[model samples]
Target: MAIKPAEIKKLASLSRLVVDDKTITDVTDRLSSVLALVDQLQSAQTESIDVSRPFHIAQRLREDEITESNKIDELQATAPEIYNGFFAVPKMID
Candidate 1:
């Protein structure tokens, strides 16, 4: 599908995109390229392809493990104020 500058401008306004007159051509070209790719994909013949079978190989995953670090005293020591093991800050709301 051929993309026009006026259409690009309209879309840009609708999508809150800032597109100047000089940049409209560039944006139109990029949009046209994307539409061309869509056309290519739509024209492909995939009726014989098996949908149940995986198209790509699966990746191996690492095992999840839990680890603990006790640094409460170290963090509390640097705070200006602490209440019940938690840092205390000035009240922000009225």
Candidate 2:
């Protein structure tokens, strides 16, 4: 499955990639090697295999905890504008 120079050119055109002659040659070589590897894989044997177990391992639950935070009055005191209990900001865009 050797990739051709013409095919690489066509691929570059379709992909909208600007590649020089050297890059095209390199890409073509790499593509050829990848295709050859795929062909080799297609011809190999894989009769007994369990492909699902590894990807479906049981997950653990996260622990819930009671947390403490600063009071709103203490935080709003640091802001320039505080309407009731909320901080106000200038309107910029809709």
Candidate 3:
């Protein structure tokens, strides 16, 4: 279905969109095209189609392992301030 300019204006007002006067026709054409495509999609036949079979899969997760990372001294070298082995940042709240 073709949308009217007045209807587009009303929709823009309701949606709080700032649509320029010159671009109204473009917006209307795009909206009409989208509505036509939606209408076409709604009229498609899928009575014998199994839509959920492609998503069926056996998902397995890898086991987690612990690793050693000793970078505290290297990271603390670049801090402006450090207190009790942690980086000291400026307080923001009262």
Clashing pairs in 1: none
Where is the poorest 10-residue window by lDDT in model 3? 59-68
Give the C-alpha miss distance for residue 46 in model 2, angstroms. 11
The per-residue C-alpha lDDT of model 3 at residue 68 equals 58
**lDDT, residue 1, candidate 1:** 83
Off by over 4 Å in 2: 44-94
TM-score of 3: 0.43
Q: What are the clashing pairs of model 2?
A: none
Q: What is the Cα root-mean-square deviation between model 3 and the actual structure?
A: 9.8
Q: Candidate 1: global Cα-lDDT? A: 0.87
Per-residue lDDT of model 1, residues 1-94, tens digit only: 8789999888989999889988888889999999887887778889998877576777778678656588899978988999899888888999
The collision pairs in model 3 are none
Q: How far is candidate 1 from the true structure (C-alpha RMSD, Å)?
A: 9.2
